[model samples]
Target: MDQAPLHVLAGALCDREGRVLLAERPAGKHLAGLWEFPGGKREPGETPLVALARELDEELGIALVEAAPLIRVPWRYHERALLLDAWCVTQWRGAPRSLEGQGLRWCLPMQADPATLAPADRAILQALRLPPHYLITPAEVLPAERDFWFERIGHAIEAGERMLQLRLPLWPRESVREFAASLLPLARAHAAQLLLNADIEGARVLGIGVHLTGAQLATLGERPLPLQQIVGASCHDAAQLAQALRLDVDFATLSPVAATASHPQAQPLGWSNFQELAEAAAMPVYALGGMVPAQLAQAQLAGAQGVAGIRGFWSAS
Candidate 1:
């Protein structure tokens, strides 16, 4: 018989400098010698919040003040499965000290090295660094519509949109490159990231992110870009998602959560199926297709890093 997954609570306690606390596993424990968020397993009959508070108090010798659900990662290690429920703790009392004989340190989430942390903690790091919105441009922007896209994208960046994709299939590569360049100054000033759809060289030359097509993901033997650059893939099923993990891509978009004009023929992976796949993934997953900004909360509840869309997330304001 399959064993039930262990419910483990993890707390990401962030300090005022945006640094998060990490605890290293001591000897003889499972995944020992590795770094992870400070927390522990939930006892039976305990709610998630209560369990997290108890674990933090026991493990870190501090009191939980304010926390919010960041992401829930369902991962399997050999025969053992665990649901790593993570919370972002912004406020707390008492200085955190290692009470369990574990080593502790503080570092910025984005600056942490994935290889140094436990496997599941890498997903949590991505969750901390990524926003709840993944924006993709429309399929085709005509010559006349260029100005409109530029204006809206500029405004979006100014409005705190840090990541977006430039998917202009109808335009020439040079035109797309130029357009991306035009936005670089503004994007840089605001610390926004720009990605091109399946355009590896363009992204490489421009020093931005690359959203891989399924075909490209399958053919690549290893990560095409370095760790600092974002690498996303379009995934539809378990196999594609597995391939994405093999490549160690930063994130993937699992699509068609509902029927839509873009892919009407594509069957929707209703919330149940979407959540199932997402839980099994070791990296952050985004819910795409038939998505709107309003569904952000619902999508996150289903184990998504966020919602991704062309029309759903676009706004000049």
Candidate 2:
């Protein structure tokens, strides 16, 4: 028998310094003492935004002023199933007080201690950590054009590309390492995160993170690196996404949301199918394949954390 999904609205209220507010579940609640994003269950006839506003007002003595969709998390507990619809509360009024006697703390998203968070809130926290645009390097960069591509990537970083995947499969291992080594300084200078694609050993040797290919993702039974390391995967279908989730990967990219030059004959998932898969996923998903930065808004609306691409992201201004 299937359990009815419980709809809940949650808010990630942010202060000016980029700190988000989290509340400790009070005694008598199902997950007492665990930290979670604030807000509560939706009442009948209420929309998610209205529920969020009402819950914040009732529980925290604050008024929700401005917010945007963050992520919708559907999780199943042993006793119940829930659909947690989270929003990024960018602007609000009044100082938040824990009117219900629960503990409240504000911290940067990356600084969140996962051990104290409720299991259902983990994916939401990870989603908050992701940026709106994910850039994947071209698979083949000729030695003659290495410097040119490097300059292009640097320019993209300068233009505010915070997360990048270095996916040079055709390059020799040593060359890839050398290139990544050289780029590390520039990446650090710009405060950008660089992930090596399908190169676990190289990523470990470089002290960076690894983005697993679908094949690699299938072979892994557990996370390849520590929680502090960024582990992502390329997922072509729901099964791949599930495997990545089971591996506790930080994020995943779902491809061919639209037709692409790289695989024109391949049928794209389109926005509707992409949304279906993303909403079912337990981690942040980036819409890949023929995606452009301009499509980020649409992708986010469809439950994606962001849009990722080789040509579209790299060529963006």
Best by TM-score: 2
107-224, model 1: which lDDT tens digit per residue?
Answer: 9987888788998888889888888888899886775688999999998998888889999988888999999999999998987788989998898898889999999988999989
True lDDT of residue 261, candidate 1: 90
**Candidate 1 minimal-lDDT segment of 10 residues:** 308-317
Model 1 off-target regions past 4 Å? Answer: 27-33, 315-317
Best by lDDT: 1
TM-score, every prediction:
0.89, 0.94
How would you encode candidate 2's per-residue C-alpha lDDT over 25-134 as one tens digit per residue?
99998899999999999999998899999999999999899999888888888978999889999988899998998999999987897768998898889888878888
Candidate 1 residue 89 Cα shift, in angstroms, is 1.8
Question: Which residue pairs in candidate 1 collide?
Answer: none
What C-alpha lDDT does candidate 2 achieve relative to the native structure?
0.88
Cα displacement (angstroms), candidate 2, residue 18, comes to 1.2
